[model samples]
Target: MTSHNPHGHALASHTLPGHDHHAAERARSVADHAAAVVELLRPLREMDRIETLPLSQALGRALVQDVAAPLSLPPFANSQMDGYAVRSGDLSDGGTHLRIMPPVPAGSSPQPLEPGAAAPIMTGAMIPAGADAVVPIEKAVPDHFLDPAKTTANTPASTAGNGNGATVRLPGTAAGTFVRSVGSDIAAGERALAAGTCLGPAQLGLLAALGLAEVTVFKAVTVLLVTTGDEVVEPGQPLPPGKIYDSNGTLLEAAMKQAGLLVRRAGISTDNPAELRALLRTEGQGADLVVTTGGVSKGAYEVVRQAMADQPVDFLHVAMQPGGPQGLGTFDGVPFLGFPGNPVSCLVSFEMFLRPALTELLGAPARRLPLRARLSLGEPGGQLTSPGHKHQVRRGSLQPDGTVRLEGGESSHLMHALAGSNVLVHIPAGVTELADGNEVEVWML
Candidate 1:
C-alpha cells in the first residue's frame, strides 16, 4: 500500500508505520532544543554586529547602550508667560508703575532689566539677567504685552532719570515664579535612556529631543527560508492530481518577518537530497540562519534529513503533537532549523521555538504573553485528551468573557481552524484531560 505524491516521492500517509517505528530514536526534549537555539544565536548578539540607525528608522529596535542627554531640556532659563519680567525687589510694598522696556518675543534674548524697570516678555522668551520673576499678561494692569512693531529704534534708557512713556503696574511677584529653569525637565549629561530599551514612538521622541539623529541597536538576523516536499507547489499554478498548494513557505516567511527577522525565501526544493544540499550551499552563505520545512520526517523520501545527514543535523522528535518531527544543527557553518510540512505545524514550531529564543537573545519580536483562562462551554473539553508523555499546543479563541474555546480538533492539517485562533492553549504532558471551566494556560498571539 505505497502511495506517492505527484513527483513520485513517498508520502507520509504511505509511511505511517515507518514514522511510528522511528519516532523514539534520537528524541529531544522541547526545553533542551529551545536552549540549544538560544545558544546557537548567542554570537549574533555580539557588539560587532550592532547597527547605527537613524532615529526615524530605529522604531521597534532595542538600544545597544545607554544614551545620555547632550544638553539640558529647555537648555536656558526662559519665561513661562507672555507678561512682564521684573525684579521681585521692585514690587516690594505693593503695586507700582514701572518703566517698560522693549518686548522680548519667543526665541529672543533680552538685555538686563534695570532696578525699577520691567521687560515685556513673551512665552518661552529668555528672562533678562536682573529679572527674578514673571507676571502673566492677564494679571498685569494693561493685560497685554508691548507691541514690538510700535517700539522706536532709539534705545530707551533704563535710568530713572530719563523719560520713558510706557509703564506697567504689576503686583508683587515671588522669586522663581513662572520660570523654566535650566535642566528643569532633564539635566545635561544624565542618562536619558538605559540600554536594551525598545525604541517606540515616545522613546524616539525623547531621542529627538536629546538632539540625537541616530542611535545604535542590534542588527536584525537574516534568515534563509526554504520549503521542501515534492507534493507541494506554489499557488497560481495548475494543480495536478495528488498535489497540494504550498502554504508552509508563505506561512513561515510571514511569521519570521513579523518577528523582525530579515527573511530571504530561497524558493521550494524537491525530495532530492543532492538538490537540497546544493541549494543550501548556494543560498545559505551569508544568512544568519537557515530554515527548511518538510523532508525531516522518518519517511523514505525525507530529503532534508538525507541531505543534512553528513552536515551535523540531528533529526529528532519533540514530545509534542502536530509538530513532533524536528531538525536542528548547522549546514556549512550556518545554523539550520527544519520543521514539519504541515502548515499548522510549521507555524506552531516557530512560535514555540524560534520566537522565544529570538526574544531572549536579540530582544526583538516582543515575547508572547502567557495567560490563564477557563474553558468555555463551547469547547469540547471531554474530547480534549492528550497523551501524558507530550505537551499539546491547541488552537483556541479567547472569548470576551475570559473563556477559551477550541478552534479545531487536534489534527495539524486544520489550517482554517488555526487562522481563527487568537491564542494557543498549553496542555502540559502530565495533564491528560481537561474539563469545562478548568483554568488553562494560554499564550496570547
Candidate 2:
C-alpha cells in the first residue's frame, strides 16, 4: 500500500522481503533521504501545542512565540557608573563648577537636573531626567567618585569639597557618556527574542529583564520505543542461558530523553513476530513516532522486520558502516523508524538521521555539533575508510591539541569503546586514506 502525504509527497510502502530484486534499489544520499522523511512528517511536529511556562522553569526549551520587550531595560535613564550625572552643556573647556543636589542612591528617585547643576548618582541609579552625561567621581577635580585608589588612600577630600553651597569642578564629557539611556539594553515594544530560540540562562535572563515571568513553548515530541531480540533481557533480571542484558533499551531511551523527547519504552521483545506486532500496535497508538532498535536486518529472527513486513516500510541497506540496515515508513498513520541492532549503530543512527530531522521540524537544538579537526591514526601515517561507501563514522577521542584518534576498530558491537569515546570521526568515501594528522569532520558526541 502506498499514498501521498498531506503535502502530496509520494509515500511509498515497502518492506524487506529477503532482499529480492526490489530491495536492491539504491537511494538518494543520506542527507537527501533524511530531509525527505522530515518533510513527510511535517504535519506531526509538536509546534501546534503551545503552553505557557514560567521563565524560571523554561530553560533548555524552545520558545514557540516571539517575545517582545514589555518594558525597556533601565526602564528609566540610569547611570552606568557610580558618579555624578551632569549635562554635557554645563561643562566648559577648562572646567565648570556646578552646585550638587542631594545624593541619588540606587533605590532613590533622582531629582531633575537644573542648568549648571549635577547629581551624585550611584551605579544603576536613575539619572535625573535632564541629565545627559555622567562624570566619574575619580575624574572630578577633587577626584572623589569612589575609585579603588581613592578609597584605599582614605581620601575624604572627594565629597568634602561639596560642602554647603559648594560646587564640584567637572571636566566636559560627551553627551550620553556613562549614562544608560532608557531601553539601552532592550527597547520597550521591540522584539526581544525571535521564536524557535532555545532558551538558555542568558536568554531567560533577557526575558526576565523584560519583566516576562511566563513564556510559551512548544510541546515535546513523544516516541514509542521498542527494543527487540530474544537474547535481549532486562538489566535487573537474572541472566538466563544465551541471553544478554538489553543495552539498546538504555541507550536509545537515554538518547531520546536527551534530545528533549518523551520516550515510552515497550521493554524487550523476544524474537516473535506476532508478539512484536501486538506490542507495537498496543504502544504506538498514542505516540507521535515509533522507533525500534534491532530486528531490522535480514536475520531469520528479525522481529521488527517480520512485524513491519506487511506495513508500508522500505527497509534498505544505507551506504554507511555499522548502521547499514534502515527501515522507515508510515504505519497505522504514525511514522515508524527502524534502526540496526548494534548499540553503536543505534546511537549513530539517532545522531545522524533522527536528530537533525526532528530538530529541523520542531526548531529544536541540533546537539550534534560538528567541528573540523585533524584525524590521527595510531601510526604516524595512516588512513581509514569504508571503501566504496561515501561516509564512514568511527568512534574517536578528540585530543587536547584538536586531533581525533580512532577509539577502536570499526565494529558496531564494541559498546565499551563507544562509551569511552567523545566524538565520531567521519572519513568520506572519496578519500581512501588519511595520513596521521589529516583534517576531517568530527561530530562532537
Candidate 3:
C-alpha cells in the first residue's frame, strides 16, 4: 500500500509474512535515539577497557589519567646564548678589561669564574656558580671567542694587558642576563596533560620529554559492521540486473575507523532472517557493537528488522529528512544500530547519532566543529523549505566570505554533492522556510 506523506512524498509499505507490525509502527525523535545510543555504548568507556599503550601507538587515543612531569624541563641552569659568563661587579668601572678563562661548551661543567675574570660559555652549557651574567660575543671588543686551549685557566685581568694579551675588554650589563633558569618551561611534578585529552603529536612529544615511554588510554571500541540486502554486491563483481554495489560497508567502515573504532566487516547478508541471525551470533562474539545498514525501513524485504524482530531492537522513524528510518537495540548480546541503505543516509545517521555519542561517552574522537553562517541560495530567487517537524541536514560549501551555499538538492543519494560539501548546514525541526542571508548552523566535515 502507498499513501502520501505530509511532504507530498509517497510512503510505501509492504507487509511480509510473520512481520511484527508493532516494530514497524514504532517511532522516535532524533534526540531520544541519540541519547539511547549513548546509553548503549557507555560500557565501552569503563575503566576495565582502558589500555596501556606505547607512546608511538597512543596517538589519537584519549588519555585516561593526568600525566605528571617526572622532572623539570632543561633540568639545570644553562646559558641562553654563546657569550662570555662573568660577574656583573667585574665590569663595575664602566667598561673594564677581564682575563679570558677556559670556554664552557654545552654538556660540559666548568669551575666558578675567578674574581675580575670571564669565561666563554656556549649556548645550553651549564653556567658556573659564581657567574651571574652573560655578554654576547658580538658586544665584546674582539667579537669572537678565543680557543679554550689557547686561553689559560684563572687568567687574572691585571696580567700583562695589550695586543695578543690574555685580557679582553668587556661592557657593563645587569646580573642574570641571558640565563635560562631551571624549571622555566615546566616545573617537576606538574600536570603535563589532564585526563580525556586526545593525544596528538605535541602531547606525545611532551610525554617523551617527560621520560614517559608509554601512556594509558581508553581502548578503541571494536565494531562489527554488517551490510544487509540481497541486491547488494561487492564492487569488483559483475553487476547483475537490478543490483547495486555495497557502498554502506566501505562508507561506514571508513567513518568508524576515522573515529578511532576498530571495524570488522561481516560481508553482505541476504534477506534471509535465519542466515542473518546465525551470522550476527557468529561475527558479534567479541565486538563491542554491531552496526548494520539497510533493512530497517517498513518494506517487506527489510532483512535486519525481520531477523531482529524477536531480539531487543526497535525499528523506528526519526523526524529527519532523507534518513528517517533507524534501528537501535541489543542483538546477540551486543549493541546494534541499523542505518538506512542510501550512502548519504548511512553517513548522516553515523554523524548524527554514533559520532556524537562516542564523543560524549568515550572522549576519543573530538566533536565536529560547529559554526553559524548566512545561508546562500545557489541560484537567484531560489528558496529552500524544510519540514517543520524534522531536522534537515543539507550539504553545503562554506565560503570564504562567511556564507554557506547549498551544494545540491536535499536528496540523500547525492554522493557527489556530499563529497564536494565542506559542511552540513542544519535547519532545525521548527524551521520551515529559509531565504538567502538567513543564519544557519553548520558542522564542519
Every model's TM-score: 0.74, 0.84, 0.82
Query: Which digits, one per residue and each the tens of the lDDT, describe model 2 over residues 1-445?
Result: 1110222111234533432433224633567657756875676655466778898777667877788888888798888898889999889878887776677899888778888778888999988878998998888866774333332223345443344454578988899999888887888888898887877789989988777789898777789999888788899999999988889889999888887888998888878988988998898877888899888777667788788878898787765665778888877878889899889889988887888876776666545788988877778656564434345678999999998888887777789999889998887644556677778898887
Global Cα lDDT for candidate 1: 0.82
Output the lDDT of residue 321, model 3. 71
- Candidate 2 regions with alpha-carbon error over 4 angstroms: 1-28, 46-48, 92-97, 140-163, 166-169
Maximum-lDDT candidate: 3
Task: Give the distance in Å from residue 123's predicted Cα in candidate 2 to where it truly belongs.
Answer: 2.1
Q: Show where candidate 3 strays beyond 4 Å.
A: 1-27, 79-101, 113-127, 130-146, 149-180, 378-382
Q: What is the Cα-based TM-score of model 2?
A: 0.84
Report the C-alpha lDDT of model 3 over 275-368, residue by residue, as the tens digit. Answer: 9999999888899999999888877788998999799998878877767888989997788998998888899999999999988876778889
Candidate 3 positional error at 232, Å? 1.2
